[model samples]
Target: MNILMALSQLEVTGAEVYATQVGNTLAQRGHKVFYVSDTLNSPHQGQYFKLRFNKRSLPRRVWHVFYLIYLIFRYKIQLVHAHSRASGWSAYVACRLTNTPMITTVHGRQPVHRSRKKFHALGYHAVAVCENIARQIVRDLGVAESQVSVLRNGVDSQVFKPLAANHGAKPVIQIIGRLTGPKGQLVYQLLEQCIDLAANQVQVISGSQIDPIFDKFKTKVKFCGYSANIRQTISQADLVIGAGRVAMEALMCQKPVFAVGEANAIGLISVDNLASAMASNFGDVADGGKTELDIDYPQLAKQLRSALKQPKVDEEVYQIITEQYSLEKMTQRLLELYQSAYVYTKKREIPIIMYHRVIHNDPSQHGVYGTYVTLERLEQHFQTIQRMGLSPITFQQLDEIGLDHRFDHGKRYIILTFDDGFKDNYDLLLPLLKKYQFKAMIYAVTGTDHNRWDVEHPSKPDQRFELMSPQQLRDIDRSGYVEIGGHTVNHPKLASLSHAEQQHEIAYNKAQLESLLERPLYSFAYPYGDHNEQTKRLAKQAGYTYTVATDSGPVALHEDLQQIRRIVMFPSTTKFGLWRKIKGNYTIKKAAKPQTKNLS
Candidate 1:
């Protein structure tokens, strides 16, 4: 596939490094990778376009957009991937002009209020470098939860290979980035205060932009001007301290990294701190407070001096780099995003049936109306699904359909899901399901023997619904018609919990259910369909393959599997109401453009 990469500048920054690495990798894989940047210094082998983006004038920026359009037509660019904000605007315009798909990888925490609507209007999906940036885009930028994804910055392990043991007597500490930046200041302070303890010699390699601070540090450290080859410099270092791309590269080189980025300082990168370190983009853009930095010069120096003697986990660090932060993994996800980009712009109509209870509906037992469905009404709902010539598939099956695009044009697809895992699902719902020879997914609350979570509801304080027993869950598992998925153990509001609590709620329940069923569990349903990005991520990290949210809509091909959309089938919903949902007649404010491309 022919692709165009757009960035405002090819400056010596983390974002530029990421674009260069990804572009080069794609080119090597036989993709026709073209690049357009304000600066033409990227080391990647690509057909480059000279597009100056620094001009603040509107006419100049407009000219660049038109030039991008011309390049799109000239090179038959299938997709435009923008790396920076300026290029995002220009590429967005170009994509709109050509009706081509576009996506942007947000490199940092950018203040995006005025352009938020413009970003939505472009209908371009976003890639966040880390989870913090992902949240920033969703909450601060107002991008839809479905429209943003996290693709962490990756390094080429092959290019930045580990060297032989070089932790010699004289500890050589290296710092690489612009000297005027926060990284430079941090490095300066560290060496100035802790020089007697931390290092025998300190090396500072910075870009062409000279800072006056370099003169002040001349006596204390070596200020080597930027070299075209950075990995080589990293290879010679005993210890490396830098932010963002430099730290990742150092880790790939099997060197211990003291990660300090523009925003925060991550003291050390190790197995215990890996998750938090990466969340902050290795301290590059740590909007979330996850790092512990002893910025006190004397204490930092003492700590570094002590740490120098400790053995390094080079292999463990290398394993992490190859597994989670490799170029290949990043490229593969990017390809998937490119292929699925059309889903965001196009409306996909499908039906997802939501159920709470299949017992007899009594008016007095339910203060909240949607929680109970009569047995007869559920039977009618199943009959309607069958009569409408729709196929009932599990959540896993739904994901597979999206992946393979195996749709029957003559017949529609309907997803049947049961929440709370009530006792009636085993006693009443299973037989009807067997009668129809249909399959469904049941999200069980593993910690409880009953639906005690609802007792605290403001409106319905006395609703004490009984949940299915452990044996019943196993029974449903034994039956081929049901897929048992995870609902939280306590069914707490996931968003209200801390990250650690959220992880325990999700991962612990998955473990409990898998043990009970004696099988690998993949599907999950959020309790009350209430979850934030953190909750969804916890579910993914817990090894769930797909998750359903209570939001009313059809699942889009590009939607995050961790937060799949589902339309609720309440007790009050009639056959006609189900049909309208099946027909996608309900109003959802986010409208999609008419689809010109077919998934099937």
Candidate 2:
């Protein structure tokens, strides 16, 4: 497949390096690849588009967009991969013009602003380099979790391999990265402090040709500007201190990494701190001050002293880089993502069948017959779904397959979600689910013993239906076919509650359910399908991978997971009606607002 890679700039930043590595690798794999950037110093062999976007005005950007279209047409580019935000915008327009698939890899710690919505508008699949950025995209930027993938940056282990530990009278400690921005001051301070050490013992590798900040400590440390042989420089150092790609490279070199950059000190990289280090990309994107390092110098000094004494890299640390942080793994994952980007790029209209109470005697006697489906009708719905070749998938499965884009289009997916955790769901729904070999997700109201939230329903007042007991929830959860989710503690109107109250209701219910089942809960259903912006934020803060609402119609691939749309089923509904909804062609009248309370 022909691919176009666009980067905002060709600077020696981690993002640029990542794009170069992946683009070159794709070319080597016999794919027609084109690399374009604002400034290109080193060129790749296959193809190059030396388009500069730096400080570009509106007209220039528009022209660049047209140029991108020309390139896409000339090369038959099937996919466009953008690296930085500016390039993302241009590529987004180009892809739209050419009707090609596009993917973005976010490398910087971008602030969550209103502009992030453009990613959705442009139909750009997002790839976050770290978990923190992924969470930010979902919670702060309002991107759906299913629309983003967390694929961390990787290092070329073959090029950046372990060298024997440097054990000499004076340890050579090095810091590598572009010495500008907020980190320059910290680098200056580090160099000044290291003046007491012999000049040969301290080394700095960066892209800045000449800076006043480093001029003061020129004689104290060897300041090499933009060396092509960075791996050799890093290999010679006894200890390497940096962040992001540099830290990963140091770890691959089997040199102990201090991971101090961007004003945050992540301390020594070891097995114990590996998870946290990897989460923030080793302090490259830490939560700290705007201008200078937020590190405690005295403590850093102590750690540095200890690090200098113990320059030997831990075997586990070496293994972590070799196994998980290799360039091959990252390239393969990107290749898979690039090839499968089309699976979820467009929305899929899959009906999420909503159920509350599946009872035996529910022909017409039930006060709330809308939510009350007879066992026979339930069987018929399942049979229709099965006969139609639709697979009933749990929310977890949908997330895994859709976000990862690892499913085939031959089989369609439908979600069976039961809200309010009725006892009949366990007694009646469980057997049919097991017998029909279908999977369903049940959202429980943890605080209430009965369906009191529905007591004040306009049609059915003072209803006292028993909710599933904790043990019953545990039972169905143990069954491999059923997954448990949260539906707020008291089932109150989340939009009406204060943010704190909403958080407690949503998060507390999740905590209680997880405690009861002894497993993590990732899906949540808003009570009564009532939620505001605060409700969505709290659901994410509560740690739900996705949430569902009572909104009508089939769920889409790009629909917010926090408000997954569902098709409410009534007793009067038939197999044909179900088929229409599943086919994304039906529009049933929404059930009464208050009816949502009692049904759950």
Candidate 1, 220-334: lDDT as tens digits:
6787877688987876777787777787877877778877676666666787877778877887676643323336667666666665665375567678766777888888778
Residues 320-372 of candidate 2 have per-residue lDDT tens digits of 77877767788877766664454334323566778888889644436543577
Clashes of 1: 0
Candidate 2: which stretches are off by over 4 Å?
117-123, 287-292, 343-600
What are the Cα lDDT values of the candidates? 0.75, 0.75
Clashes of each: 0, 1
Q: For each candidate, C-alpha RMSD in Å?
A: 11.9, 11.9
The stretch of ten residues in a row with the least summed lDDT in candidate 1 is 591-600
